[model samples]
Target: MSEATTHQIPGLKQKKVFKIIVLGDSGVGKTCLTYRFCEGQFLDKSEATIGVDFRERNIKIGHEDIKLQLWDTAGQERFRKSMVQHYYRNVHAVVIVYDVTKPETFHSIASWMQEVESHGLMRAPRVLVGNKCDCGTPESRLATTYAQRLADKYGMPLFETSALLDSECDNVESIFMTLAHKLYSKQPLRVVSVEGELGPGVVTLGRQKRSASSNDSCLCS
Candidate 1:
Protein backbone atom coordinates (compact mmCIF):
# COMPACT_ATOMS: atom_id res chain seq x y z
CA MET A 1 0.00 0.00 0.00
CA SER A 2 1.11 3.58 -0.61
CA GLU A 3 1.67 5.89 2.33
CA ALA A 4 -1.88 6.96 1.51
CA THR A 5 -4.36 6.11 -1.25
CA THR A 6 -6.28 8.55 -3.38
CA HIS A 7 -10.04 8.71 -3.98
CA GLN A 8 -9.92 10.11 -7.52
CA ILE A 9 -12.64 8.59 -9.67
CA PRO A 10 -10.36 7.94 -12.69
CA GLY A 11 -6.79 8.43 -13.87
CA LEU A 12 -3.94 6.69 -15.69
CA LYS A 13 -3.82 4.30 -12.70
CA GLN A 14 -7.11 5.25 -11.11
CA LYS A 15 -7.90 2.07 -9.22
CA LYS A 16 -10.75 3.81 -7.31
CA VAL A 17 -9.46 2.32 -4.08
CA PHE A 18 -11.81 2.20 -1.14
CA LYS A 19 -11.24 0.81 2.35
CA ILE A 20 -14.42 -0.70 3.73
CA ILE A 21 -14.76 -1.75 7.35
CA VAL A 22 -17.28 -4.41 8.42
CA LEU A 23 -18.50 -4.19 12.02
CA GLY A 24 -20.93 -6.06 14.27
CA ASP A 25 -21.09 -8.09 17.44
CA SER A 26 -19.46 -11.51 17.32
CA GLY A 27 -21.45 -14.35 15.64
CA VAL A 28 -23.36 -11.91 13.53
CA GLY A 29 -21.91 -13.69 10.49
CA LYS A 30 -19.49 -10.87 9.68
CA THR A 31 -16.93 -13.30 8.30
CA CYS A 32 -19.48 -15.31 6.37
CA LEU A 33 -21.04 -12.17 4.98
CA THR A 34 -17.67 -10.85 3.83
CA TYR A 35 -16.64 -14.21 2.40
CA ARG A 36 -19.88 -14.39 0.50
CA PHE A 37 -19.32 -10.91 -0.90
CA CYS A 38 -15.76 -11.72 -1.90
CA GLU A 39 -16.20 -15.36 -2.97
CA GLY A 40 -19.94 -15.57 -3.86
CA GLN A 41 -20.38 -18.73 -1.76
CA PHE A 42 -21.28 -19.05 1.89
CA LEU A 43 -19.37 -21.20 4.36
CA ASP A 44 -21.56 -22.38 7.22
CA LYS A 45 -18.63 -23.51 9.39
CA SER A 46 -15.77 -21.29 8.30
CA GLU A 47 -13.08 -20.58 10.83
CA ALA A 48 -13.84 -17.87 13.36
CA THR A 49 -11.85 -14.63 13.29
CA ILE A 50 -9.38 -14.36 16.16
CA GLY A 51 -8.63 -10.66 15.66
CA VAL A 52 -9.20 -9.46 12.10
CA ASP A 53 -9.39 -10.80 8.57
CA PHE A 54 -9.34 -9.20 5.12
CA ARG A 55 -10.03 -9.79 1.44
CA GLU A 56 -9.83 -7.61 -1.65
CA ARG A 57 -11.89 -7.56 -4.84
CA ASN A 58 -11.80 -5.33 -7.91
CA ILE A 59 -14.92 -4.21 -9.74
CA LYS A 60 -16.01 -1.89 -12.50
CA ILE A 61 -18.43 1.03 -12.32
CA GLY A 62 -18.80 2.38 -15.81
CA HIS A 63 -15.20 2.82 -17.02
CA GLU A 64 -13.58 3.24 -13.63
CA ASP A 65 -11.67 0.33 -12.13
CA ILE A 66 -12.71 0.07 -8.47
CA LYS A 67 -10.90 -1.92 -5.79
CA LEU A 68 -12.42 -2.76 -2.43
CA GLN A 69 -10.34 -3.56 0.61
CA LEU A 70 -12.71 -5.10 3.13
CA TRP A 71 -11.62 -5.31 6.75
CA ASP A 72 -13.52 -7.72 8.99
CA THR A 73 -13.05 -6.39 12.49
CA ALA A 74 -13.29 -8.71 15.50
CA GLY A 75 -16.55 -7.75 17.21
CA GLN A 76 -15.86 -9.06 20.67
CA GLU A 77 -15.47 -6.38 23.35
CA ARG A 78 -12.09 -7.71 24.46
CA PHE A 79 -10.63 -7.28 20.99
CA ARG A 80 -12.17 -3.86 20.54
CA LYS A 81 -10.71 -2.60 23.77
CA SER A 82 -7.14 -2.97 22.59
CA MET A 83 -7.51 -2.17 18.90
CA VAL A 84 -6.02 1.16 17.87
CA GLN A 85 -8.35 3.83 16.53
CA HIS A 86 -6.35 3.96 13.30
CA TYR A 87 -7.88 0.61 12.44
CA TYR A 88 -10.98 2.58 11.50
CA ARG A 89 -9.19 5.64 10.16
CA ASN A 90 -9.34 6.82 6.55
CA VAL A 91 -12.06 4.36 5.60
CA HIS A 92 -14.12 5.05 2.51
CA ALA A 93 -17.19 3.13 3.65
CA VAL A 94 -18.61 1.14 6.57
CA VAL A 95 -20.79 -1.98 6.75
CA ILE A 96 -22.66 -2.51 10.02
CA VAL A 97 -24.13 -5.98 10.40
CA TYR A 98 -26.38 -7.85 12.83
CA ASP A 99 -28.04 -11.24 13.10
CA VAL A 100 -31.70 -11.06 12.21
CA THR A 101 -32.53 -14.03 14.43
CA LYS A 102 -30.97 -12.32 17.40
CA PRO A 103 -32.69 -9.16 18.58
CA GLU A 104 -29.82 -8.33 20.91
CA THR A 105 -27.46 -8.22 18.01
CA PHE A 106 -29.67 -5.73 16.24
CA HIS A 107 -29.88 -3.66 19.39
CA SER A 108 -26.12 -3.63 19.75
CA ILE A 109 -25.74 -1.70 16.49
CA ALA A 110 -26.10 1.58 18.36
CA SER A 111 -22.96 1.02 20.40
CA TRP A 112 -21.16 -0.29 17.38
CA MET A 113 -22.17 2.77 15.37
CA GLN A 114 -21.08 5.01 18.20
CA GLU A 115 -17.68 3.40 18.27
CA VAL A 116 -17.40 4.01 14.54
CA GLU A 117 -18.32 7.69 14.81
CA SER A 118 -15.67 8.14 17.44
CA HIS A 119 -12.94 6.41 15.47
CA GLY A 120 -13.75 6.56 11.78
CA LEU A 121 -13.29 9.21 9.12
CA MET A 122 -16.29 11.46 8.70
CA ARG A 123 -18.96 11.16 5.98
CA ALA A 124 -18.02 7.73 4.65
CA PRO A 125 -20.82 5.90 2.88
CA ARG A 126 -22.29 3.48 5.43
CA VAL A 127 -24.46 0.40 5.04
CA LEU A 128 -26.50 -1.47 7.63
CA VAL A 129 -27.19 -5.18 7.15
CA GLY A 130 -29.05 -7.90 8.98
CA ASN A 131 -27.22 -11.15 8.23
CA LYS A 132 -28.14 -14.83 8.68
CA CYS A 133 -31.53 -14.26 7.15
CA ASP A 134 -31.23 -17.67 5.45
CA CYS A 135 -32.14 -19.85 8.41
CA GLY A 136 -35.60 -18.39 9.06
CA THR A 137 -38.18 -15.95 7.83
CA PRO A 138 -35.98 -12.95 7.21
CA GLU A 139 -38.63 -10.31 7.82
CA SER A 140 -40.46 -11.87 10.74
CA ARG A 141 -38.21 -10.65 13.54
CA LEU A 142 -36.83 -7.24 12.53
CA ALA A 143 -39.25 -4.40 12.05
CA THR A 144 -38.69 -2.98 8.59
CA THR A 145 -40.26 0.28 9.63
CA TYR A 146 -37.74 0.76 12.42
CA ALA A 147 -34.79 -0.33 10.34
CA GLN A 148 -35.80 2.02 7.55
CA ARG A 149 -36.10 4.83 10.03
CA LEU A 150 -32.62 4.07 11.33
CA ALA A 151 -31.25 4.00 7.80
CA ASP A 152 -32.89 7.28 6.95
CA LYS A 153 -31.48 8.85 10.08
CA TYR A 154 -27.95 7.97 9.04
CA GLY A 155 -28.46 8.15 5.27
CA MET A 156 -27.36 4.54 4.94
CA PRO A 157 -28.83 1.64 3.00
CA LEU A 158 -30.41 -1.08 5.13
CA PHE A 159 -30.68 -4.68 3.96
CA GLU A 160 -31.66 -8.07 5.32
CA THR A 161 -29.20 -10.37 3.54
CA SER A 162 -28.39 -14.07 3.51
CA ALA A 163 -24.97 -15.16 2.31
CA LEU A 164 -26.35 -18.68 1.85
CA LEU A 165 -29.17 -17.66 -0.48
CA ASP A 166 -28.38 -17.46 -4.15
CA SER A 167 -31.03 -14.78 -4.54
CA GLU A 168 -29.39 -12.58 -1.93
CA CYS A 169 -25.98 -12.65 -3.56
CA ASP A 170 -26.72 -9.50 -5.50
CA ASN A 171 -27.78 -7.71 -2.36
CA VAL A 172 -24.39 -8.32 -0.73
CA GLU A 173 -22.63 -7.10 -3.85
CA SER A 174 -24.91 -4.09 -4.19
CA ILE A 175 -23.83 -2.64 -0.86
CA PHE A 176 -20.27 -2.23 -2.04
CA MET A 177 -21.19 -1.44 -5.62
CA THR A 178 -23.46 1.39 -4.57
CA LEU A 179 -20.79 2.77 -2.31
CA ALA A 180 -18.19 2.55 -5.04
CA HIS A 181 -20.48 4.25 -7.53
CA LYS A 182 -21.34 6.98 -5.09
CA LEU A 183 -17.68 7.72 -4.52
CA TYR A 184 -16.83 7.56 -8.19
CA SER A 185 -19.81 9.53 -9.40
CA LYS A 186 -19.15 12.45 -7.08
CA GLN A 187 -15.71 13.16 -8.51
CA PRO A 188 -14.98 14.86 -11.83
CA LEU A 189 -13.83 12.33 -14.44
CA ARG A 190 -10.25 12.64 -15.63
CA VAL A 191 -9.06 12.10 -19.18
CA VAL A 192 -6.19 9.66 -18.64
CA SER A 193 -4.27 8.64 -21.75
CA VAL A 194 -3.88 4.92 -22.35
CA GLU A 195 -2.15 2.87 -25.05
CA GLY A 196 -5.01 1.42 -27.05
CA GLU A 197 -8.77 1.23 -27.46
CA LEU A 198 -10.42 -0.07 -24.23
CA GLY A 199 -12.24 -3.39 -24.59
CA PRO A 200 -15.98 -3.64 -24.52
CA GLY A 201 -18.11 -5.41 -21.88
CA VAL A 202 -17.47 -5.50 -18.13
CA VAL A 203 -14.02 -6.68 -17.06
CA THR A 204 -14.45 -9.71 -14.85
CA LEU A 205 -12.98 -9.30 -11.35
CA GLY A 206 -11.48 -12.84 -11.46
CA ARG A 207 -12.17 -13.36 -7.73
CA GLN A 208 -15.33 -15.45 -7.94
CA LYS A 209 -13.52 -18.74 -8.47
CA ARG A 210 -13.09 -19.89 -4.87
CA SER A 211 -11.88 -23.41 -4.16
CA ALA A 212 -12.26 -25.46 -1.00
CA SER A 213 -9.35 -27.00 0.85
CA SER A 214 -9.15 -30.63 1.99
CA ASN A 215 -11.31 -29.87 5.04
CA ASP A 216 -14.12 -28.41 2.92
CA SER A 217 -13.51 -24.78 3.84
CA CYS A 218 -13.22 -22.07 1.24
CA LEU A 219 -9.60 -20.97 0.98
CA CYS A 220 -8.14 -17.92 -0.83
CA SER A 221 -4.44 -17.32 -0.51
Candidate 2:
Protein backbone atom coordinates (compact mmCIF):
# COMPACT_ATOMS: atom_id res chain seq x y z
CA MET A 1 0.00 0.00 0.00
CA SER A 2 1.06 3.56 -0.65
CA GLU A 3 1.94 6.02 2.14
CA ALA A 4 -1.07 8.14 1.25
CA THR A 5 -3.43 5.23 1.71
CA THR A 6 -2.04 4.37 5.16
CA HIS A 7 -2.67 7.85 6.54
CA GLN A 8 -6.35 7.79 5.54
CA ILE A 9 -7.44 5.57 8.42
CA PRO A 10 -10.76 6.92 9.73
CA GLY A 11 -12.12 8.33 12.99
CA LEU A 12 -8.89 9.51 14.64
CA LYS A 13 -9.81 11.62 17.71
CA GLN A 14 -8.11 14.43 19.69
CA LYS A 15 -7.82 14.04 23.47
CA LYS A 16 -5.70 15.83 26.15
CA VAL A 17 -3.17 18.60 25.55
CA PHE A 18 0.54 17.70 25.52
CA LYS A 19 2.83 20.49 24.39
CA ILE A 20 5.86 19.07 22.52
CA ILE A 21 8.67 21.05 20.93
CA VAL A 22 10.84 19.80 18.05
CA LEU A 23 14.36 21.23 18.02
CA GLY A 24 17.23 20.56 15.64
CA ASP A 25 19.57 22.21 13.14
CA SER A 26 18.44 23.48 9.75
CA GLY A 27 17.23 20.90 7.14
CA VAL A 28 16.86 18.13 9.71
CA GLY A 29 13.19 17.42 8.83
CA LYS A 30 11.49 18.66 12.01
CA THR A 31 8.59 20.10 10.05
CA CYS A 32 8.13 16.89 8.11
CA LEU A 33 7.75 14.83 11.27
CA THR A 34 5.23 17.26 12.68
CA TYR A 35 3.16 17.16 9.50
CA ARG A 36 3.34 13.40 9.17
CA PHE A 37 2.21 12.72 12.74
CA CYS A 38 -0.42 15.44 12.96
CA GLU A 39 -1.83 15.74 9.45
CA GLY A 40 -0.85 12.28 8.18
CA GLN A 41 0.37 14.02 5.06
CA PHE A 42 3.79 14.51 3.50
CA LEU A 43 5.32 16.76 0.85
CA ASP A 44 8.58 15.81 -0.74
CA LYS A 45 9.08 19.39 -1.95
CA SER A 46 8.84 22.01 0.78
CA GLU A 47 10.61 25.03 2.22
CA ALA A 48 12.28 25.23 5.60
CA THR A 49 10.05 26.12 8.54
CA ILE A 50 10.10 29.84 9.33
CA GLY A 51 9.65 30.93 12.96
CA VAL A 52 7.17 28.24 14.05
CA ASP A 53 4.54 25.94 12.70
CA PHE A 54 1.78 24.29 14.74
CA ARG A 55 0.14 20.90 14.45
CA GLU A 56 -2.12 18.82 16.71
CA ARG A 57 -3.03 15.15 16.89
CA ASN A 58 -4.90 12.90 19.29
CA ILE A 59 -3.04 9.91 20.70
CA LYS A 60 -4.23 7.19 23.09
CA ILE A 61 -2.24 5.06 25.51
CA GLY A 62 -4.19 2.29 27.29
CA HIS A 63 -7.08 4.14 29.03
CA GLU A 64 -5.47 7.57 28.87
CA ASP A 65 -6.21 10.32 26.32
CA ILE A 66 -3.59 12.74 24.92
CA LYS A 67 -3.56 15.63 22.47
CA LEU A 68 -0.13 16.56 21.15
CA GLN A 69 0.49 20.22 20.37
CA LEU A 70 3.53 19.71 18.18
CA TRP A 71 5.67 22.81 17.57
CA ASP A 72 8.10 22.93 14.63
CA THR A 73 10.72 25.65 14.99
CA ALA A 74 13.11 27.07 12.45
CA GLY A 75 16.56 25.54 12.90
CA GLN A 76 18.70 28.13 11.13
CA GLU A 77 21.23 29.97 13.31
CA ARG A 78 20.05 33.29 11.90
CA PHE A 79 16.66 32.59 13.47
CA ARG A 80 18.02 32.27 17.02
CA LYS A 81 16.25 35.39 18.23
CA SER A 82 12.85 34.09 17.14
CA MET A 83 13.61 30.59 18.46
CA VAL A 84 14.57 31.74 21.96
CA GLN A 85 11.42 33.80 22.21
CA HIS A 86 9.30 30.63 22.04
CA TYR A 87 11.57 28.36 24.00
CA TYR A 88 10.68 26.96 27.59
CA ARG A 89 7.25 28.09 28.73
CA ASN A 90 4.37 25.60 28.68
CA VAL A 91 6.59 22.94 27.11
CA HIS A 92 5.82 19.51 28.54
CA ALA A 93 8.33 17.54 26.48
CA VAL A 94 10.99 18.08 23.80
CA VAL A 95 12.22 16.03 20.85
CA ILE A 96 15.77 17.08 19.89
CA VAL A 97 16.19 15.82 16.34
CA TYR A 98 19.24 15.60 14.07
CA ASP A 99 19.97 14.35 10.60
CA VAL A 100 21.73 10.98 10.55
CA THR A 101 23.25 11.70 7.15
CA LYS A 102 24.89 14.91 8.41
CA PRO A 103 27.42 14.28 11.18
CA GLU A 104 27.70 17.99 12.02
CA THR A 105 24.03 18.07 12.83
CA PHE A 106 24.64 15.26 15.32
CA HIS A 107 27.51 17.21 16.89
CA SER A 108 25.25 20.22 17.46
CA ILE A 109 23.45 18.35 20.24
CA ALA A 110 25.57 20.18 22.82
CA SER A 111 24.41 23.56 21.55
CA TRP A 112 20.81 22.35 21.57
CA MET A 113 21.25 21.12 25.15
CA GLN A 114 22.51 24.56 26.09
CA GLU A 115 19.47 26.15 24.45
CA VAL A 116 17.17 23.92 26.50
CA GLU A 117 19.03 24.73 29.73
CA SER A 118 19.20 28.47 29.05
CA HIS A 119 15.44 28.50 28.61
CA GLY A 120 15.15 26.89 32.09
CA LEU A 121 13.34 23.95 30.51
CA MET A 122 16.02 21.41 31.29
CA ARG A 123 13.73 19.59 33.69
CA ALA A 124 11.24 18.84 30.94
CA PRO A 125 11.33 15.27 29.59
CA ARG A 126 13.39 15.08 26.38
CA VAL A 127 13.86 12.59 23.54
CA LEU A 128 16.88 12.55 21.21
CA VAL A 129 15.75 11.70 17.70
CA GLY A 130 18.03 10.74 14.79
CA ASN A 131 16.05 11.56 11.67
CA LYS A 132 16.58 9.95 8.21
CA CYS A 133 17.52 6.67 9.84
CA ASP A 134 16.71 4.87 6.62
CA CYS A 135 19.82 6.53 5.24
CA GLY A 136 21.91 4.96 7.98
CA THR A 137 25.02 3.41 6.51
CA PRO A 138 28.27 2.16 8.10
CA GLU A 139 29.44 5.79 7.97
CA SER A 140 26.27 7.03 9.68
CA ARG A 141 26.72 4.64 12.64
CA LEU A 142 29.10 7.20 14.15
CA ALA A 143 26.33 9.78 14.24
CA THR A 144 24.07 7.27 15.93
CA THR A 145 26.69 6.70 18.62
CA TYR A 146 26.94 10.44 19.31
CA ALA A 147 23.18 10.70 19.49
CA GLN A 148 23.13 7.92 22.10
CA ARG A 149 25.72 9.76 24.19
CA LEU A 150 23.57 12.91 24.26
CA ALA A 151 20.57 10.83 25.30
CA ASP A 152 22.65 9.38 28.16
CA LYS A 153 23.95 12.78 29.23
CA TYR A 154 20.43 14.15 29.55
CA GLY A 155 18.96 10.83 30.77
CA MET A 156 16.44 11.15 27.95
CA PRO A 157 14.92 8.61 25.59
CA LEU A 158 16.24 8.15 22.01
CA PHE A 159 14.48 7.27 18.77
CA GLU A 160 15.95 6.72 15.28
CA THR A 161 13.17 7.63 12.87
CA SER A 162 12.37 8.10 9.19
CA ALA A 163 9.34 10.29 8.53
CA LEU A 164 9.25 9.01 4.95
CA LEU A 165 9.25 5.33 5.87
CA ASP A 166 7.12 5.58 9.03
CA SER A 167 9.87 3.90 11.00
CA GLU A 168 9.54 4.42 14.78
CA CYS A 169 6.33 6.39 14.30
CA ASP A 170 4.26 4.02 16.41
CA ASN A 171 6.46 4.60 19.44
CA VAL A 172 6.54 8.40 19.12
CA GLU A 173 3.08 9.02 20.51
CA SER A 174 3.69 6.65 23.42
CA ILE A 175 6.78 8.63 24.44
CA PHE A 176 4.68 11.78 24.81
CA MET A 177 1.98 9.86 26.68
CA THR A 178 4.51 8.42 29.10
CA LEU A 179 5.91 11.89 29.78
CA ALA A 180 2.39 13.21 30.37
CA HIS A 181 1.62 10.41 32.84
CA LYS A 182 4.87 11.04 34.71
CA LEU A 183 4.19 14.78 34.88
CA TYR A 184 0.62 14.21 36.09
CA SER A 185 1.67 11.70 38.77
CA LYS A 186 4.22 14.13 40.22
CA GLN A 187 1.55 16.76 41.01
CA PRO A 188 0.66 17.20 44.69
CA LEU A 189 -2.86 16.45 45.88
CA ARG A 190 -4.95 18.71 48.13
CA VAL A 191 -7.75 17.52 50.47
CA VAL A 192 -10.35 19.47 52.45
CA SER A 193 -12.75 18.15 55.17
CA VAL A 194 -15.46 19.46 57.50
CA GLU A 195 -16.07 18.31 61.12
CA GLY A 196 -18.84 18.93 63.66
CA GLU A 197 -18.10 20.91 66.89
CA LEU A 198 -17.36 18.78 69.98
CA GLY A 199 -18.10 19.93 73.64
CA PRO A 200 -16.02 22.77 72.29
CA GLY A 201 -13.86 23.18 69.24
CA VAL A 202 -10.27 21.94 69.89
CA VAL A 203 -8.79 25.47 69.87
CA THR A 204 -11.42 26.93 72.27
CA LEU A 205 -11.22 23.89 74.60
CA GLY A 206 -7.43 24.12 74.92
CA ARG A 207 -7.58 27.90 75.56
CA GLN A 208 -10.13 27.48 78.43
CA LYS A 209 -8.02 24.78 80.19
CA ARG A 210 -4.87 26.98 80.02
CA SER A 211 -6.77 30.01 81.45
CA ALA A 212 -8.18 27.97 84.39
CA SER A 213 -4.68 26.61 85.30
CA SER A 214 -3.20 30.18 85.19
CA ASN A 215 -6.05 31.53 87.43
CA ASP A 216 -5.41 28.79 90.08
CA SER A 217 -1.61 29.60 90.08
CA CYS A 218 -2.39 33.35 90.60
CA LEU A 219 -4.73 32.54 93.61
CA CYS A 220 -1.97 30.37 95.19
CA SER A 221 0.59 33.27 94.77
lDDT by candidate, in order shown: 0.73, 0.69
Query: lDDT winner among the candidates?
Result: 1
In candidate 2, what are the lDDT values of residues 1-221, reduced to their tens digit? 12322242234233436677889999988987777777665547868887888888776645656677888888988877655565456686788888889988888988998988877668777888787777767674556566677789889887877777754566554555566665444321100000113233433534575687898888666
* Cα distance off (Å), candidate 2, residue 44: 1.9
Clash numbers, per candidate: 0, 1
Q: Could you tell me how far off, in angstroms, the CA of residue 196 lies in candidate 1 after the best superposition? A: 34
TM-scores of the candidates in the order shown: 0.75, 0.70
Lowest summed lDDT window (length 10), candidate 2: 187-196
Candidate 2 overall Cα lDDT vs. reference? 0.69
User: lDDT tens string, model 1, 94-137?
Assistant: 88999888889988988987877877434667889988777666
